[model samples]
Target chain A: MDTILFLFSLFVLALFLGVELITKVPPTLHTPLMAGANAISGITIVGAILAAGADTSSTLVHALGFIAVTMATLNVVGGYLVTNRMLAMFKRKS
Target chain B: MNITIVNLAYLLAAVLFILGIKGLTRPKTAVRGNMLSATGMLIAVVVTLLDRSILTYDFIVAGLVVGGVIGAVMALKVKMTAMPQMVALLNGSGGGASLGLAAASYLQSLERADFGTGAIAVLAVFFVAVTVIIGAVTLTGSLVAFAKLQEIIPGKPLGFAGMRYLNGVLFLASLAGLAMLIANPGNTPLFWLTVAVAAVLGLTLVLPIGGADMPVVIALLNSYSGIAAAAAGFIMGNTVLIIAGSLVGTSGLILTKIMCVAMNRSLTNVLFGVMGEVG
Candidate 1:
């Protein structure tokens, strides 16, 4: 538990700093940053599905697990779509 | 019979999750992924309901209905610009649920001595307690992040030159506290203290992270919540929980790496870049 939380917190800090540093760099990297973050959110879909199988005794647990999975799927799907759309806006002329 | 049905549902759900991930890779198939994942979830719910031992199904049903209604309303109403805030809220809710479950299990164990003070039982309880604290911190800190992103709170990073050093010290302290708790089980005060400190650390650490960096933070917190849930599963000896937790942990880390590359930043730069000012 401690290991997971500590790693997660560390990741959050990494993200924070990454965003902070980007301002000093060129704007060309924004699309990539967004894409990367989108993938991170996608991980939740896997987690939700896994949680679905964790408990076999509670009806509520099963129901909640499914709900989480669905919600995460939406986030992942919508997130990627939005990222793609944003990238499209940045297309450069040949 | 119930176990068989539940396991089957889990199997179906796992397949759906895989399909959903595949669908999510491209814009054209994103909707399909959403549908597949939702279907998997539905299967899970139905199978769980087949279980005969759930004494509180009635209340659970009522709670489900209420939650469903509220969730639908939010889905229909939230603006795209506010999506990150919504994500933050959802992540916080997930963390809260994990914390609540861990606490409930701990209390249940204390009252019933269900496992009779065995070494495994003690380990289970400790894992649950630690998970609960970590989850609580994630929940509260994520909510605060949402507020900051929404401008309900300040978006600026907050700290001094030595603040990062202070955070490091606090982390070590939390680690020591956790070690002590493990050394002596049933230390409720120590458990709560560990939780309080961790929670503060989560907020302080996050507060300095700018809104521009929220996307990755959200992903990382989502991973934390998954882990907390996994630990709860450990206490209950739930196989699904462990699988799900590991999946998130791995994926979230991968995503974090991708984000670092996208920003042309190193992980160390991000972790220690808590400079006092931002434009």
Candidate 2:
């Protein structure tokens, strides 16, 4: 199969799956869910790492890559930690 | 070190990401889900570094350490009341990363004379252009949304005469720039011009959105960043990126829809109404 065509199919499947996954989440959890999803968006860190480390010869590319890596790491680390903090408050009393 | 092994690792990471989102559906599993997703990210980063034989580990290590510390401190210290703003800023950072990656890729390609004049090259340029525009827009737009939510900028709708008309013009200009980019992939000047216009478009589009609509705006921008990353993945032929990006895009869109519904406003109204101030 063509790679792009396969990617589009995967994209459509993920779309439906995403809606199905979150449809039942209550409003009270919306903030934490959003935070959690924000953390997931930090998946760009993968791309950033590749870009930053792919070529060390070009200073400009290196700078861009380094910045990307730093910003993405911040997103991933901060996002997860904050989501965990928020979810901690939602726990039921023992 | 084998290519197939790296691909398999990426595939595994993608599955972990999906499971992470699924876990978030329930409060009891939300924290675990977050961890699952973070683990997935770690796996992906490590695999990319080892598989690609990246020559510069020092910069990457420095970025991770500094960024991790800052993120941890912010997460630990931020108030719940500021959670929305924090999410907005995090989303912005992801968008910033996408923009940075796209820019780096473009510059590197230019240096290597990789932008060959072929159908495939045009298609690759199209994806890169999409990445640049969407990534830039998401970065600035999310920042504006963050400022509004943070109350650093006024939360009231800031409209000027014929703002909608101006936005329309800017949107059309970006499309024109995109067409130019596809026609000639080596046109770096045109590419940066398009990105700059898109950045302004993002600012104008979000400036008039009031504070009440910030949550929806943030969610929508989150989707934008995901779509931008997906475009970057297309350019790089990275399957895991495409999968993870689409997952975030779809989930963010769903969340935006839910927020709109919760606010009793349609998506169109939230975006175009610009009348969110309630006495």
Please tell me which predicted candidate would have the highest DockQ against the true structure. Answer: 2
How well is each residue in B40-124 modelled by candidate 1, as lDDT tens digits? 6556555655555554444445434554555556645666567667667666666655665555455445445464455655566
For every candidate, C-alpha RMSD to the true structure in Å: 8.1, 2.0
For candidate 1, the per-residue lDDT at A11 reads 40
Cα lDDT for residue B20, candidate 1? 54
Alpha-carbon error at A83 in model 2, in Å? 0.6
Q: How close is candidate 1 to the true structure, as a TM-score?
A: 0.72
DockQ for each numbered candidate:
0.07, 0.70
Q: What TM-score does candidate 2 get on C-alpha atoms?
A: 0.94
Q: Report, in order, each candidate's fnat.
A: 0.00, 0.74
lDDT of 2 by residue, A11-69 (tens): 67766766676677777778888888888778888888888888648888888888989
Error of 1 at B203 (Å): 0.2
The CAPRI category of model 1 is incorrect
TM per candidate: 0.72, 0.94
Number of residue pairs clashing in candidate 2, backbone atoms closer than 3 angstroms, sequence gap of 3 or more or interchain: 0
RMSD of candidate 2 to true structure, Å: 2.0
